[model samples]
Target chain A: MKTYTRPLDLKNGRVDMSHGSGGRAMAQLIDELFARHFTNPILAEQGDGACFALPVGAGKMVMATDSHVVSPLFFAGGDIGCLSVHGTINDVAMMGAKPLYLSAAFILEEGFPLADLLRIVQSMAQAAREAGVPIVTGDTKVVEAGKGDGVFITTTGIGVVAEGIDLKPSNIKVGDKILVSGMLGDHGVAIMSQRENLTFETTIQSDTAALNGLVATMLDAVPNIHALRDPTRGGLAAVLNEFAQASGHGMLIHEKAIPVRSQVAAACELLGLDPLYVANEGKLVAYCAAEDAETLLAAMRAHPLGRDAAIIGEVIADTNAFVQMETVFGGRRMVDWINGEQLPRIC
Target chain B: MKTYTRPLDLKNGRVDMSHGSGGRAMAQLIDELFARHFTNPILAEQGDGACFALPVGAGKMVMATDSHVVSPLFFAGGDIGCLSVHGTINDVAMMGAKPLYLSAAFILEEGFPLADLLRIVQSMAQAAREAGVPIVTGDTKVVEAGKGDGVFITTTGIGVVAEGIDLKPSNIKVGDKILVSGMLGDHGVAIMSQRENLTFETTIQSDTAALNGLVATMLDAVPNIHALRDPTRGGLAAVLNEFAQASGHGMLIHEKAIPVRSQVAAACELLGLDPLYVANEGKLVAYCAAEDAETLLAAMRAHPLGRDAAIIGEVIADTNAFVQMETVFGGRRMVDWINGEQLPRIC
Candidate 1:
């Protein structure tokens, strides 16, 4: 094996154009930094790509990709590194699949600090370690100083869904109950606090987490679940709207039934934002037959990541396919999809 | 299905932050732009992730990723769009696998022209079509203007290698012959020409292409091929060094036998670059037992992409693991791995 004469100056060094040059500097970075942090048999092989046999009896393969251009790389609870992993894992898990592996590609801006890069990478390694999904293959590129943000990480995940487990929005049927795994808007509120430099008595941390374990528990408890989706990007309202549009049904939810952290709600109110339209990195929305809703909620609440689970709504027969919320005061209004950018680069 | 009142104005539109805000604007862009160009059954489902069953006879799975941050979006022959698909496909193909599907993630800069984005997407769809690989899922994120270049694309490919066809650098034998599929340095020279604004008598065009078909042909003729790789970022020299270090052997090549177009050589000379150190997107290197060399070469020559194929070198037993080239004038010198950036963002 090739060896570097000296170790990388991780503390004082900055990312230069050479680090992405595909030469000695790039090789050293891979060997000393990436390879060391993401140690695995497949990655250690250092082939152009990673090769592995699918586990016997594994079902259909599911693939998902997400680009993390989140501003303020570091938020209250997670950095872009961990967010990159958790975000895609949840996407695959939403399909009722077991995420097996991940591939990462990075576009780094020239002159970014190596120390920050190290911190981000370490966070990713820790997240992947906890999730039991190895990042088996990756690529890196660098743009001129002014041509890029500090860094953008794009992660792609591969998973397998066991036979007879189908979770699609089209499977949603009228009279099905809609449940949320946890509180909404924590991630979005956390990010907003950071961006606004808001100081609240209670700090709200982004709820970035890998939800595969929670999903597996729910699937075990209710194998006939119809639809599952993470409340990301456009949050609970967006997910409900998607379900309504896909299934040609209306979504009816009680505003009082949804779970939201007091601090998050206060933050949203102060910022003139609605919690329904805010994003959540860790929470998921599920649909099941009315009889199975209690069992599903119990399974979700038992999981560490889903302790605040609740059945918040139900699908209804309506020609307009609207998502309406019954207010706490007994009046109702539509919980429509967001119209424009509330926050940019909010993961 | 939800419908947009007006279609995306591809001719006069520019990407804005809302296009990535996971709102109505983002949905419209996806519905009218991405969904229209990359139309396939899997993508038409509009799920967060794409799901499919692996072929029954498919062997081990292969996964590869590449991030294309090429300087100019468009070049003489190909742009970053086709290059992104070809780059990842070639990486997966180098593993002796049949590429099955692709997932793309794009980081677009706010204020980037929508027309250019359309061109890139159309190019990507066309490339994927020509390669018989469908882009099953994708993501788009827009950064604030000036935070990113016009666009950066990262593509991840999944493939399956048939049983009994293993290709790895460690498989190379000391006496194996090394073969190159076609000419070298065309891609580097082409990009350099654009960057330098040098108009040559004969314009140099990038050689970016998907090599899966060519790879399939070679494998059919010589299933015992020892090693295979696409000479991409660090070009021929980097690949040779990688092979030598992995196999604990040395590489010895005759410079006269290497293929380089006259224009490419002139451009490299003007740019003070060594053709051996320049990048080639479509080219590949192969290592085979001496007995199978002729058969592999014959098969490669019959392929359109390998008409300029040649046996340029051979592996040798050397404890130091060096890469050397015999000059056309009979003098020998070492072809060392590149030490610094030659061309940044050269796909």
Candidate 2:
């Protein structure tokens, strides 16, 4: 048996071609570093690919993929590792499904610190465990230094949705109630502050989280929910506009009802940003029947992940399919769709 | 009817924040640029997202996502636009499925040319239509100039695999015949020739193509194929090594049995690159039972896209899981996995 207690020389060492050479050096690195940290039955098999049995079911499977390329790999609350897992898992959950397996492909830049890679892989493993999702299959490729940033992660998730539950944007109807899971703009603001070298008296942490539990609760309360969307990149306003346009209906959101933490609001105000258009990693937007709105809100609030849940808007019949918001002072304005990238490289 | 055409000053125009600000300018850009080129029933609906009915099926659905960030957006044989669509569609098809729909997300640099963007979008539409896949839903964001390369495309594809087709690496066994779809190194050599400013008497064009049609033919001929893989980034050697390790088998490939174009070979030689390890955009590696090999090979050769198909190797029981080649000169050497990203951003 080989003793494996050596500390990784993360500081001085740089990733070389050998790391991807598919030789003894590559195998050793995988065994001593990645495999050790991401230990699981499937990954430990040490095969070129993972093989496992899928649960027997007639349910429809939902799959989604997302790539993470946020600058400054490490952020206030999460790094690219955790973001990679969270982003794809959220995408799968948004389809009203239970996420099962995840496949990750890493594009690593040569000269990247091995210790840093270990940390990221470990974080991804931890996130997967917490989300109750397995990292089943993966690929790793190292690009030369100048050709890549520190790291880029592309994650694909597969999930199964039980029959009789067909969720679609077209399912939304006039008078549908819209509810938000929690505070907005935290993740976007936290990343921006770190990247722009801005600081405030009160620290802002990213709301990077897995929302499958919250989704499960919402589904339990209202099985026929119209639609579920995670307001990630382009935030609340963008999601609402998307829903309205997709369903061919207008939306009326109450600005006072949408949740935004004070710190996020302050940061946005100082930076001349709109919290509504910023990103949120942990939060979700759910549209349901007005009759089931309270039941859904209560269920969301009951979950730890959705403590700040609130009824933010309602759907309306309009060919224009506009998304309008009632201001805190009672003025109505359009909460339009975002046209371009908000904060580039935002996961 | 309104008639309108404008000369685009790509060099002088700079994108302001309003381009993504969800205002009139954003709407105009989308209508005049993106929507114009990507005109289709699903996209023309102008919904925040797309809604369409899936073909009736109890078949399993396969989905894959890929991000394209190749430099010199327009390459030797294809641009980043078509590459994005082709890459993900091939990923889904490699599972022995018929690709259905695609979703694209664009991250455009602030100063990128609208005309260039339109050209790319047109190419994407053409490729998607040619591949029999629809671009259903998409998201676009513009990053500030220094924050990103000119453009990055992330494409997601969804496909449906027929019933009873169980393809997996675990299905691979000793004595399994290995097949290469067509010529190798065309894509890598073409891109490198352009990148390195190397000129040759014969211009090397990339073999960038959609392989779903070829896959369907092979599947119809030999339904019990063990595994199918595309030799893309790290190329034939990487994929073969992966399959060998996954199946716990060694491989013996005859160099003469592999197909390569003369120009590609010359380009690789000049660059001191191995054709075995160089990428091929439209090629595949199929491992199947020896009994079905002839049928599969005939089917592949019949396809216009796979006229150069060849039975290159066979799987052998070995704990080492090595990939070895029998050279044309009767010499034996290892055909190992790639060490690093060969020709970064080629795809």
Candidate 3:
């Protein structure tokens, strides 16, 4: 093992156009940074793409892609690195499958700090390691300084789904029960706080966590989930609206049953943001047999990432496919899809 | 099917932040443009990720990802949209796999022209259709105007590699022959000419193509192919060096045998660039047992993409793994890996 006597100036050095020119400098960066952190037998092969053997007798497979352009590279809780990893993984897991491998492609801007790049990569590696989903293959490109954000990551995930364990929003039944794994609005609130330069004595951290483990536990316990979705981008309201539209049913959610951290709620009030429509990365909504709701809720609460899980709503038959919520003060309000997302680049 | 009464003013409107806001406006753009062009059953499902059934008893799976950040979204022959699709598809095809599905993620800058975005998406869809590969899933994010170039695309491809047909650089052996599928530097020269505002009498076209058809032809004609790679970013020199180093051997390329178009040669000459190091998008390099070289060459020549194919080099035993070229003047010189790539974002 050899170490450079003079390593890259991670503190003060910046990325140059040549680093992505597919030459020795590019090779050195891959060898020292990407390959070093994302080491595995498959990635080490370094072929045009990584190749590996798959498990015998696996079932159907699913693939998903996500582009994370979150503005503030680093947020209160998670950075874009882990968010990229977790987001794609959760997409695959939402189908009730175990993610097998991932491919990450990064676009970096010239003059971006190497220190930030390294930090992001290290976090990406850590997320993959924790999720048991290694980044098996990846690509990197660099654009001119003024032509790009510091960095943008696009992660694609592949996973295997066993036969008869399908999860799709269309499969949702009118009588199904809805459950939230945890709090809402924390992720969007945290990002907004950072961007608005609001200093909170107790920072509201983004709830960004991989959901496959929690999903596995729920599947093992309940065994009859109709659908699962992470409340990202458009958050809980968007998800419910989608489920209603796709399944040809209506949703009746109870506002009091939804979980929201106190700090997140305060930040939402300060920013005039509705927690119901704000994003949450670590949370998920599941629709299942009414009888299985308690069992799934129990399993979810038993998991560390879902201690505050609760049943939030139920699916109802309606021709218009509307989503309605009962307010805490016994008034009704429509949980309609917003004209535009309140938050941008919230991931 | 439905059409917007006042459709997005594609001819005059610009993409605003709301187009990626993950709400109604974003939904409208996806429905009117992306969804309309990429119309398929899987895409119509519009879940977090598209899910589909795979053919039973398909072989081992392979995945590849590439980010296309080529400046000037529209190039001489192809735009970034089609290039993104072909580039990732070729990466998978290099492993001798039949590409099955593709996923595209786009990062568009706020204020980018809506007309341009539609044109690019249409091109992307056409390319995917022509290649017999469906873009199964996608994500779109719009960054603030200054934070991104007009657009950047990252595409990930998944293919099923039939058993007993493995292609890796390590599989190359001494006494193997190296072949170039077609002329080099066309893709790079074509882009450079447009960038430098040089109008060739016969406009040089970017040789961006999906090579799976040609690859399939070669594999069927000669099943014992050792290694295959698309001569892309770092060009033929990089591929040859990688093959030599991976196989722990050396290469002796014949400069006289390597193909180069006159216009490309002229461009390279004007730029003082070596044609050997310039990129070719639609071309590939193959290393195989020397005895089968003629048969493979015949098969390649029969394909549309390989009319100019020729045996450019051969492998030899050398611990140093040097790549020495025999010039047309009967002189030998070392073809070394460059300190950095001569071109950036050529793909």
**The candidate that achieves the highest DockQ relative to the unseen native structure:** 1
Model 2 alpha-carbon drift over 4 Å, by segment? A1-12, A15-65, A137-148, A158-160, A166-174, A244-250, A315-345, B1-65, B137-143, B158-164, B169-174, B199-201, B316-319, B338-342
> What does the i-RMS of model 2 come to?
5.8
Q: List pairs with backbone clashes in candidate 2.
A: A340-B141, A341-B141, A341-B142
TM-score of chain A of 1: 0.98
Superposed by TM-score, candidate 2 places the C-alpha of residue B132 at a distance from the truth, in angstroms, of: 2.4
In model 2, state the lDDT of residue B141.
52
Q: In lDDT terms, which candidate is top?
A: 1
Q: lDDT per model, in order?
A: 0.92, 0.77, 0.87
Per model, the share of native interface contacts recovered reads 0.88, 0.05, 0.76
Report the lDDT of model 2 for residue A138. Answer: 60
Binned by DockQ into CAPRI classes (incorrect, acceptable, medium, high), candidate 3 is medium
Give RMSD to native, each candidate. 1.1, 4.6, 1.9
Relative to the true structure, candidate 1 reaches a TM of 0.99
lDDT of 3 by residue, B125-169 (tens): 999999999998899898887999899999999888877888988
- Which prediction has the highest TM-score against the true structure? 1
> What is candidate 3's local distance difference test score?
0.87
2 against 3, candidate with superior TM-score: 3
DockQ of 1: 0.87
Model 2, C-alpha of B89: deviation from truth (Å): 3.1
